[model samples]
Structures are given as structure tokens and as C-alpha cells.
Target chain A: MRTITKNGVRIDDTFAEAFPMRGTALILTGPNKRWARQAAVTMTGFATSVIGCGCEASIDGEVEARDTPDGRPGVRVLIFAMSSNDLQTQLVNRVGQCVLTSPGSACFSDLVAADALKVGDLLRYFGDGWQISKKFGNRHFWRVPVMDGEFLCEATTGFTKGAVGGGNLLICGADYEKTLRAAEAAVEAMNEVRDAIMPFPGGIVRSGSKVGSKYKALHASTNDAFCPSLRGMTKTALDDDIGCVLEIVIDGLTEAAVADATRAGLAAIIKLGPRNGARRVSAGNYGGKLGPFHFHLKDLLA
Target chain B: MTLVLTLKVTPPQRLDLSVLLPHLLADKSSKDVAAIDLATTREKITVGDLFRIRAGSAEEIRFEGGSERFDGVGQGLQQGRIFVAGDAGINAGRQMTGGDLVISGNVGPYAGSAMTGGRLEILGNAGDFLGAPREGELNGMSGGLLVLRGAAGRRAGDRLRRGTILIEGDAGDWLGSRLIAGTLIVLGRVGVSPGYLMRRGTIVLAKPPALASTFVDCGQFASSFPAVFGRFLLPESRGAARLFRAPLRKFAGDMAVLGKGEIFVPA
Candidate 1:
């Protein structure tokens, strides 16, 4: 494979390692955009990774009022987990606590066809016999009474198979400021890609990890191969002039989505060129031992 | 495509055509459809005797001529859609399970009685015991959606166990009387004794109705419950949707019974 270079930026001939994950999409609506967005943000908060929260979630996009079930301002959110059971647990807990508690907010499933999990069925207990169940079209919804009024939620949410999680792009630059700027631009561009979400804070992950740690009990540790501090002690993947590094982690409903987001992010960073300190773009993989989906950098941007 | 049944002559007495649902005739040919039995006042009669039948595979079945003497229009319907062109008699949709039933004109008593599932839309008025179960049965309209565009007679949604009934016009006395569990939304004026002996269910009244002595006012407050409930009504009518979006006065009552039923009036 031939490497592509734009100005001083090098596109590595590597691939991102992704594993199969279970996930579901939810639509949260409110009387207004502010309340809807607040509910969505709260539901996706503290959900950066399955390592800490047992799920990864983020606001995917905004929905038009006419398109929603209630003609209210709404947002689309996606949550992914390693297992379907874990995904369901996270979905019920987060929605029950965040969306059901939000004033004038309602939660709905975004999937049209798939195996469904009973999200609202489990949460309706909070209504304490006051709950009302409604069947509209082909879907069932629950109306749980609350202080703000009632929280309407779909009874079930659908999940699909072969969803890719943990695809990444490592941005290395000449200095901290330039590298960070390019990474920020890349994150912004990736956010526009459909069906994919960057789960880390601001869509950038600084503490990139490897499969194992020096401590026996740890499953993952810092990526010493790319760490600037460990460059002298370890066989570093970066060059001598590389001063700053940032990683963008992507999780998507499909491998194609992850690849598209990666290609978009790389193009956005490449557009910044050497002047912005974008030196090279690489990816993280565990020597083909990680997972099934592999998004090659060269083939993606080709 | 639609299966059209147009009456050729007026009937002297009531004709039980409840077997004329979409599910029964969807796959049948015109010749086969016309052979279906209809019990009239005089004797058992074939559908071809008094009406013309044009058949197709479409899920929609339309009755073209006036059917003032026709009864049990969609009884035991399991699937498909039904459209009645004119007035129909009693027991229009008894024990309906699934599908959509639309009546362009008025229907007599026991409309949507014991309906288990599906949607029934009455463009005109309905008679007594709308969505009510039969005398021997314990539940009425266990599941389904019943929308009445015009006024309803007494005892609307009586003993309803499940399902939703939306009345665009006024409801007569005993609205939702003895409701077991279900939702009855009256967009227009409601008559006396609304929610009487209700055990558990929801009654949304656009125009406040006179409550029984057993009820207790829960106080008027700003709420979003109506907005949520209103969304479900959007597909039925825009007026109904708007009726539920505003603040409402809620009353928990039918205290004479189990007392879990609630009535919400637009504030």
C-alpha cells in the first residue's frame, strides 16, 4: 500500500480495529428545543465509554418538530454497549433518570425494524398504577405521570447486529497547539458524518490505551508507543519533532459509517496542512487480535 | 383497490351484515363475496340478493348505498379496513379485534361494543353503549381505538376494560360509566355523571362535565400530561390534538368505586 501525503501530513498505511457492539437509538422530545436538548445531554452525560459507564452515548442530531411523534422539538441519541443486556440496562437507567425526570420531555425509539427491548415497559413502574399504555400505529408507548406532567416513552427499542465500536484516528503534529487544532477540526468534521458518533469528550481522546497494563489487574493501560513522555524509554511510533498527539475514537452503527467518519476526519485534518502542525495521521490496532472490522486508512481516503 | 357493496333496494326490516368485514372478503372473488350469508328479518339471505358486489384484493371495503337497516357491520373483525357510505344500524363493530372501520354516516346503539383491537372511526353520531361490552361479558373494548366525529348517546365507553375512545362532539349522560380501564376523550361537551363508578381509566373532557358526588377535585395546575396525550390524538384530529396541549384541571374521582379513575378538563 502506498502512503498519501498532503503538504507535510502523512497518511499511514494502517487500519482501525473495531469490535462488534450492541446499540440502540432513542429520540427525546420536549415542548421546546432547549428542554429537549437538556434532556438529551443529560442522558448522554458521563457516558464516554463502556470502560467506565458500561455504555457510550452521545447526541447524534436534531429532529424537526413536524417529524416527531408529538410535533415537538426533539433530538436523536445513540447508545452502544458490548452486550445487549448491558445496553438495555444502560438505556433504562439513563432514560428513567434523565429523560423521564426532564420537564415536558418524552422518549421514543428511533429504530423501525429489529429485535426490540422493552425500555418503557420496565420504567412504567414509576407511575405506580397511574401509567397509561397506548398503541399508535405499530408501536406501543407508555405514559408515566410525573410532577412536570407525564413522561411519554416508547415501550420498546430495537437493536441491530454487526455495529462497529472502538474505531480510532491518531493525530500527531509538530507541536501541541497545531496538533490540538487539527484534532479539533477533525472532530468537528466527524460530527457531521451520519450514523457515527465520537464518544470521548469533545470527540477527542487524549489518553489512548493499549490492551494491557503493567499492573496485573488492569485490562488496558496508556499507549506508551505513542506517548511523548515515554518516547525515550519505549520504541515510539512518532518522529523526534512530534510534540503533540490526540486520538479521535469513533463508534458507529455500521462499519461503513465508521470508515466514512474516519475518511472525513482525515480529510479535514489534511486540509489544515503543515502550517497547522498536522504531521501524520495513524490508527490504533492490536496486531489483528482486536476485532473483526478493520478500516484501512489508505483505502478509506483513497 | 376497494370492495364496493351497493344496496339495490331498501330493506323493510333490520339485516345483520356483521360478516361483511374486510378480513372475511379480502381474498374472495365478487361471486364468492355475494354468496356470503346475511340474516335478515324474514330469513337467511345471500349478500347478492339485495346488493351488488365488486371485489378486489385491497384491504378497504366500502358500502356505497344507505344501510339504515344494516346491523353488526364489522363484528369480529380481525384485520383490514371498512368504510360505510351511509347510516348503519346497531352493533356496528361488535367484538372487533383488528383493522380500521370508518363509517361516513350515523350508526345506532352498541357501536364498537366489546372491541378488542383495531380502529373504528365514525364520521357521524353514535347511539348508546358506544364501546360498551355485552350484558354477559365483563369487559368492553378491551383494546382498540374508537373515534366518533359526532355526538354519542348515553353510556359511552361503559365498562371499557382497555382501548381509547375519542368523541369529537358532545357525549350524552353516563359518559365512561363503570369504566374498568381505558381512555375516553370527549373533545366537546359532556353530559351528566361523567366518570361515574369508574375504577381505573382516563377521561379527558374538553368541556367540563358535571361530576358525581363521589369525585374529588385535585386542583388546577400547569401540566404537560395533556401535551403527551395530545400527541396520540394528532392522527385522529387536529382539534383533539390542540385540546390536550393546553393546561388542564385534573380531578381524581369515581371515589365511590376503587377511585383510581381521573378526569382532565382543559383549564
Candidate 2:
């Protein structure tokens, strides 16, 4: 199949396959947006992947004061786990340690539907018998009397099957500077698309990994094939002109989410293709051997 | 003034008089209000066959004649006022959310359970769990006010979250047990464990208890009572501004749990 190239950028034929996982979202609010971001960053810390951290979470977006329950600046965080029980455990621990510990901060469940199982109902006993449960409208919230008045958290959280590792695109440029620029542009484009998150440092991954390491103790190692400096020594796939490669991994809750992110990333990269030394943009795949669903880059861009 | 339909005789079996409150009969005329449906001894009876129907507005309702076994007279009434001249049966003013319900005589058990808002003033004695929860429910009397002129049976104002319960006379044991919030003012002596497992809110007692184990004396200070009760407690001619008193004794307790709630015994 002929790969689609837009403005001298190569769109790989392979797709980023994803799998279904249980997910929950939390809303954290404080006196201002700064405190809200503080609590959010702490709550979603060390939650990049389920393989080691037991969950994958990130700040989905920021919410306005009117959208919050207590009329404060807040952020929406989405957490995904392998199962419902694991999701509940990780949520209880993270929320208890991060959001509840923060002064003038309150946590609430973003998902209001009934399917969300409750985790706060059991954790409320930390109030040490002083916890008060209030049912407003159809939602039940627990008021754990803290030092600063009360820490009101939703009694339950709504759960749904969300797509993980959905849309991933790797950028291979003429040099490190060009590759970094291309990846940064792709991240900005993907950020414009809703319902998608690139849960990594700066939305760019320099140390791309394969499924397993050469050593017996490690599960994953660096992708040496994509390394331009070690081209002749190792089984390298990059051409002579391609000097640097950076990966942009995207995960969303639905198929449209992956397609939208892919479209945005491609659009942004193509827009900056002339000035930047960006050579080509491709995708990472294991020959359709990993996750179930896939988002073909060419099909998504078209 | 809504008309009240009083049963002339107390039947052998239990009666359900939940339909006889003023708010339930608010839209009906005085004559039609008196002709409400009643279930007595497994038989349906009309109001015209029982007591007289006086013509008035739906604001006030007066019940007379029957002194034995009248049940659920003002259950779940949200507005208007109800006055029972003689003794009432079981579940009088049960779950009353708003308006006023005044019973001149004694009342049976479970009065004002699950009441979200309203006022229930009983001039005579009351049965068990007055202003308390049903058998298994967790919360009781989230809002509104409940006043008992005479004594009340066990577990009065149990697990109350909001509102005030003022009792002029003595109260039974385990009063205000597991109170979540709100104020319970017992003008008379209270039984043991008055504020058990109380997390927050104030509970004021006029008289002290003989034994003191759970509650710890926090401090003595005054509290401002809300001004809305003057119109309800005093005569109609007097305005609601005259009922201002300060410096109430504040004693915090049920410290065995969180030690946040207070019990103010009048100094």
C-alpha cells in the first residue's frame, strides 16, 4: 500500500491498537485555579501507566466555576485501570493521599451516572465516626469534617469502558531539533482535540520501548531500531536522511477520540512542515499483535 | 380554615386517618373536606356520617369528638395548620414537613419520623421515638421544629441532622442518641446518654442529669436563637421580634466520637 504523504510527511499504514478498560473521572476544586492544578497534579502523579503504577491517569481538562459543585475553579482527571476493583483501590488511595490532604481542596466524582461504583463510602470512615452523608438530587456525597471546615467528596463514581493506547504517531525528522519541533507541534494539535490525552512528559516520548528487553529481568527496553546515531551497528529501520525520531502516544475513551487526535496531530505537523526540518511522521505498531482496536493513520487523516 | 371530620366511635380494629389533615384537604370545600375517606375496622366511612363540618379557609383545621384510637391525623402535611382538640391515636403528625400541627391530648408512637421540615407541637404526652426515625432508617428529622409540652418517650430526636426539638417537660432515656447535627432543647430533665455519638450541632438541656460519663463540659457561653419562633410560640397579636435571649450555656459532648457537638444547660 502506498503511504500517504502530506507536505513531504509520511503517514504510516499501521495503527495504534487499543483495549477496553474500566475508567473513572474525578473533579478537584479549590479557592483558585492554582490550587486546583496543584491538587490535580498530585492526584494524577505517578499514574502514567497501569503496568507499574497500577493506573493511567491525567488531567483531562479544566472546568469552569459554574460547572463545579461548590462554585470553584476545578480540573477533571480521568483514571483507567485493568478492572473495577483495581480502579476503586487506586482511586481511594490517590484521592485520600492527594486531594484530601490539600488544604482548601475538595474532590467530587465527575461521572454522575448510576453505573459508577462508590469508593468514598468506604473511605469516609477515616472521618473517625464524624462523617456525614448527604444525598443531594440523585447523587450521594460524604462530608468528612476536616480542619478547614469540610472535605466533601462524592460517595460513588461512575464507571465505563474506555479505550487505552488508542492513537499513536511517531515523528522522524532530519535532526533532534526538527524531531522535537514536529512532536511539539503534534502535541499542540492533539491538545485541541477533546476526549484525548497524551499522558507523558510534555506529550513527547524520547525513549520509545519495544515489548521486551534483551535481559531476563526487564519487560521493556529502548527501541534501538529507530535510533539514527546507531544506524549501521544495529538493525536500524531509519533512512540516512532521518536523524531523530520522537513518539506521540494518544489514549481516549472512544474511537472518534483517537481519529480526532490523529487528524489534529497530522494537521499541525503538516502546517509546520516547511519551516521546521520535519522529514516524516509515522506510527508504531506490532503487526496488529497487541491491543484489539486499531486507528489506521492514513484512514484517520483522510 | 379547613373542616375536620372526627370519628364518633373508636372501632375494635386499627384505623388509618392519614387522609384527615388540613393540607390534604386544602383544595376541597368545608363540606367536601368533611366528607373525606376513612378506613376503620376494615370498613370505609365518610366524614359526613361522623362529625360536623364547619365552613372556613384551609389555613386551620380543628378535630373534635373522638378521643380514642384516631391514627395519623396530620401525616406528611407540608402547609396550613391542624389542631386536635382531644386525644389522638397512633402516628399523629407523622413525617410532617411544614406548617403547624398541635394536638391538645396524648399521642401514640412514631410521631414526626423522617420529617424534612415543619413544626409539630404536642400539648400532651407522647409515645416512644417522638421526632425519631422509623425502625431501621438511619436519618431522622433532617429539618423543621418539633415541640412537646409534656414528657416524651424513649429516643426522642434520634439521629437528627437539622432543626430544633424543644420539650417543656421531662424526656425518656436515650434522648437525642446518635444526633448528627441540629439543636435539641430539653427544658426539663433528660435521661442518660443525652448526646450519644453526636458529631456536631448544639443540644441544650434546662436540667442536668444525675450521672455524667460520656459528655464533657466544654465551656459556658451564649447563643442567639433564630427569630422566627416568636410568632409561632407567642400569641398572634405579638410580633416575632420579642424573643431575643443570649448567653446560653454551651457544653460540647459525645466526645467519645469527635467531641464537636455541644449541650447547653441553662445557667
Each model's number of backbone clashes?
A: 1, 8
Compose the digit string of candidate 2's lDDT tens values, residues A1-302.
Answer: 34677887776666776667777778898878999999999988887677788887878889898677666789988787778888889999999899888877777787755477666687688899767555422455666767765677778888777556535888889888888988998898788776677777777778777789879999988889888778999998787778999988777766677788888888888878735846777777777876777777777764
TM-scores for all predictions:
0.93, 0.64
lDDT of 1 by residue, A214-242 (tens): 89999999998899988889988888878
Q: Identify the candidate with maximal lDDT.
A: 1
What is the C-alpha lDDT profile of model 1 across B113-137, one tens digit per residue?
9998888999999999999987798
**Best of the candidates, TM-score:** 1
Displacement of the residue A67 alpha carbon in candidate 2, Å: 1.5
Candidate 1 colliding pairs = B18-B72
The residue-level lDDT of candidate 1 at B163 comes to 79
Native contacts conserved, per model: 0.29, 0.00
Pull out the clashing pairs in model 2: A116-A157, A116-A158, B1-B57, B1-B58, B97-B117, B97-B118, B222-B247, B222-B248
- Tens digit per residue, CA lDDT, model 2, B145-186: 777888888888888877767777888888888888866767
lDDT of 2 at B59: 75
- Candidate 2: DockQ? 0.06
Runs of candidate 2 exceeding 4 Å displacement:
A113-119, A145-149, B1-37, B41-112, B115-267
